[model samples]
Target: MSPRRILFIQTQGENAGAQEISRLVGAGLGARGYDVSHLFFYRKSPSFDAPPNTRYCSHDRPRGVLGALKFPMQLLREIRAIRPDAILTFQHYGNTVGGIAARLASSAPVIANQVSARMLMNPLVRTVDLALGMFGVFDLITVNSSDMLMDYARYPNNYSKRLRYIPHGFDLKTTDLTKQQARAAFGLPPDVPLLGSVARLNAGKRLDAAIGTLADSPDWHLVLAGQGPHEAALRQLVVEKHLETRVYFTGELPPERIGDFLAALDVFVFPSRAETFGLAAVEAASAGVPVVASDLPVLREVLASDGQPAALFVDAADRCQFTDAISRVLNDASLRADLIAAGRGLHARYSVARMVDEYEQLLRDLLAPVPQLAPQS
Candidate 1:
């Protein structure tokens, strides 16, 4: 039997969580004898290298509405050429446009993967998604968190039967580094009570709240490891709060270096106002760093191990609550130990291998079976 050709379409090729998820799933399937390919809906080439057997199509258009409008046709052309067995798309623009393109081209079974709940905020997009679903443009709609799935279910025109929740997997790296060694590698002071978070410096991430917490607590330092459009504003805010010397912004660490960064942290903080699935928090748990995250349903679902919460939760809106949670984790040795132990239990359920296995099964099931012919009549 010939290997299944699975094509993945994503809005942007940037080094964001959705892009990373697509890469991991696509690469894993390719390794297991699936002919997997990835297509960027927009023109700008991604900084990361393409996975094996993956191809990126360039349709260079200036960013924003113009580019989004032109994307479906470009994507349709690619789908017709590839003639894939299955198509999976990630993010808002990709899902809506990719689904339409696949339908137009008669490409394959379309799987629209929603990584964030951002779509709910946009009425137009939600309307388009519903239209696509009703028209059978999307064969399946996958979300990473149960909370996000519930949010979509509440929509008036939702295609509830087509929705599926598939959690993101963590590909943890092994790092044999002591706290002191890890701090030195990242140029962080070994003595300070370091609070760390790995996130894009975006408004939704609510990193400014973390900076404010650091400002009030002179004894603690913060290290945010990631880059985004909000960096300049965040830096200015940090300066305004007089946290310049204490706050360290590690522009963007590569995948290998993330384990070392996690090793150096005293506590991991995820203060995002909106998070579909806190992948970074899960990675921190894998590293045994006690976490303090926003009290979101997605966090509760992902951070729970054996019916116990692996990480501390607090409302992102309440800065004091976030700080208090971090302080509790830092000041109580027993609490830290308990959280770390519980975090270790998450490794089995959220492994990259497990995620790939589930995705592989779904893709294979979606593949169109060969047509049957009547026996000699």
Candidate 2:
């Protein structure tokens, strides 16, 4: 028999968490002799090097009523052409529109990956998601965190039955570059205590909190290493606080360079207001950097292993707590050594190979033929 075909649908073809997960999982499936293809609704970012066998539905994200109407038809055509055995959709647009298009175009099972619970805050979006679940628009919905799975389970009706928890996996390879070398690559000072975050410059990330931490730690420098809508506002906050000289904006770093970025940092700060999974924190830990992140349950789930926490938890909104935690990790040698040691084995637990194995098993189980019951006498 021929190899099973899989297609991934995501919103933007950028170097974000969802896109990165799709790329990693797709590559894994391909290595297992599966035919994998990636489809994106928006144009691929010029800086992003998308995986092999990728296609875009539009030159840019749909802007108006006409563009919105046009997207689904284009998506439907792509779905029909791919004729995949299974379709995995990522992000909001991919989960909603992509799921609908797959349902209309093919008999394949559709698995919608929900990377965040923030959308539930919007009543209209929540209602639409529930309605779609009730109507069986998707065969399954995968959530990266157990917190998210439980959140979705709270909704009434068939929504609970379709929920599945699958943590995002990472390669977590160790970088050969030393802290000094990595700092040199980013044009950062060689000796200063560096705090950094590799996340989008969005309001939800609460990057402003990171800037606040720098205010109390005059000797430290902060690196904001991603691009998003909130860049201008964050830049303004840096200026307002008179931290323009200490804060560095590296725009968006490519996937390959993420390790070097993490290597250069003394502490990884993740002040996100919300997250379905903390991918950046995991990357930081894997790079042997101590992490100080928001005290969110989902974050706790991702940053801990074997009941021991791998990061220092703090309130994302409290700059004092953030500053104190960073100070503790930096000044206390024993604590810092323990955190680094604990984080060293994280790669073994959240490895890409493990993630791919789970995905492969899930796909097989999903596609298996149901055994029929014999007639009773």
What TM-score does candidate 1 reach? 0.91
Alpha-carbon RMSD, candidate 2: 4.0
Q: List the residue pairs that clash in candidate 2.
A: none
**Number of the predicted model whose TM-score against the real structure is largest:** 2
- Candidate 2 off by > 4 Å: 119-121, 368-377
Off by over 4 Å in 1: 42-49, 59-61, 64-73, 118-120, 156-158, 371-377
Residue 225 CA displacement from its true place in model 1, Å? 1.3
The C-alpha lDDT values of all candidates are 0.82, 0.86
Q: Largest lDDT belongs to which candidate?
A: 2
lDDT of 2 by residue, 129-193 (tens): 67777788878888888888887888776887988778889877467899999999999999999
Give the clashing pairs for model 1.
none
lDDT accuracy of residue 4 in candidate 1: 80
Give the least accurate 10-residue stretch of model 1, judged by summed lDDT. Answer: 42-51
